[model samples]
Target: MTNGGWFNHYDDPDEFWDDEPLPIERTPLNPSPSPSPPQNPSSPPQKVVPTPKPVEPQPWTTGPVSKSAGAERLQSGVGSSFVAVQVDAGLLPVHVQLSPQWHRHVDGSEAGAELMRAYQKAIGIYLGETIKSGKYFSGEFRHPSAPPDRRTVLMLLLETASWADYRETQTRIYARNGFEVHGQAQIQNEPVTSMRANWFQVKSIRIWPDWARRADPIQIVDEVLCCANRVRELRPTFKIRGDYSRYSDEDLEYQHLQHRENLIEELGV
Candidate 1:
């Protein structure tokens, strides 16, 4: 109160709480059993209507949904579907439509379409075209916001990525992080040194399909950054490029000689 420009409630701070009495915690007897009001006895005996049993749902075999139902729902476009997974449960087989966060992040990216395609393809391969009555793949993985810095995910991507594109992207990512990657170009034709086997193609829709579908944005960036740093640490040949790294000795010398020649030609009688 003194500093806030408000008058103090009491002149003596000790007087208010010092003499305060504690409240008594007494329990009252005769607790009401039920809160319903007393009913009138004079009313004529009312007829008790029996509740009708609910109609049992038809079996999946007998009750197939019309194809138009799905089309109508999709056309509504009131909400987005982020997660699409094959499910086998209950009598009717169906996919649980969830909005996965990956769909949100990758929707606009050039890779987004590819990711969706991979996810679709995986569903069929993993669970089959028609969802059976059973649990298939559960999107329960607690994907980190960014991939791990351990480069595990990056290595997977690199293994599948086209050698040139993967190498180039890896180099640029490393450079952006203030480092360089060695043997980036050498990776093109050289025996695979990073992984034990090579199965993925550059821009293959199959690279970490489920992972791409579930990982959050933060986890995705984390994986790339962690991998880049790990790669730089592993390869010592990769050096830090200086400002003049782009200019070769030959280029510099030729430029200087041309300048000198021009000066001499201009000055000659």
Candidate 2:
């Protein structure tokens, strides 16, 4: 120690300072991620597929039957060129076309008779086809192919007459209780025409000429069918008066059969 001064405590300062600095162990703020293993070069490259979107389901619908697909046409073997008639599946006439040569071969006086003959022939063909296709009922009501016994013949005649009477009664009932309904046609939100129906038939129709010219034929048919369906729904509401008022269709049919049986018993046939 010297007066007012500090002294170094090393035996040799040069020997302590002469040694190389030791390597420092330090940590970085952000470390690098570990590398992935290398893939095999011979292997095929993996495909990157996109995720599929969900599909929405579609609604089901039915379309109306086409006329050409539903109707059948036949040529009646009458006149020189013959008459062609088109009918639907239910044997309701759709169209009747007369050839130009019809008048040439058929006289004006006999034209009506010839036309009826043609209609009969076409109807016969239709019935034959229906029977062949097994669509016609092969029930007890079917006509016998061979000659029938006296009792069978009598029964057939009675049945025919009974059915005729039943139809006549139905017609009379309808005539008595017939009520009219009105239907209207619209074009572009405007009333274009109206139709009046008496029970099952269209009694009268009044169409605006201007609207008729612009109205769609398909729309007209649709409106008419709608009105007809409305009328059909009312058919069951027409009740007969007196004893048959409460009778259902089946009940009326049974009553007719019972009456026929009673007649047969009375005649001993």
Q: Candidate 2, residues 51-147: lDDT per residue as tens digits?
A: 9988532211111222112222222234224455443333323445556555456454443344345444555566545544444444323322223
Best by lDDT: 2
What lDDT score goes with residue 167 in model 1?
Answer: 46
lDDT against true structure, model 1:
0.35
Query: What pairs collide in candidate 2?
Result: none
Indicate which candidate wins on TM-score.
2
Off by over 4 Å in 2: 1-81, 88-92, 138-269
* TM-score, every prediction: 0.17, 0.26
lDDT for model 2 comes to 0.44
> How many collisions per candidate?
14, 0
lDDT of each: 0.35, 0.44
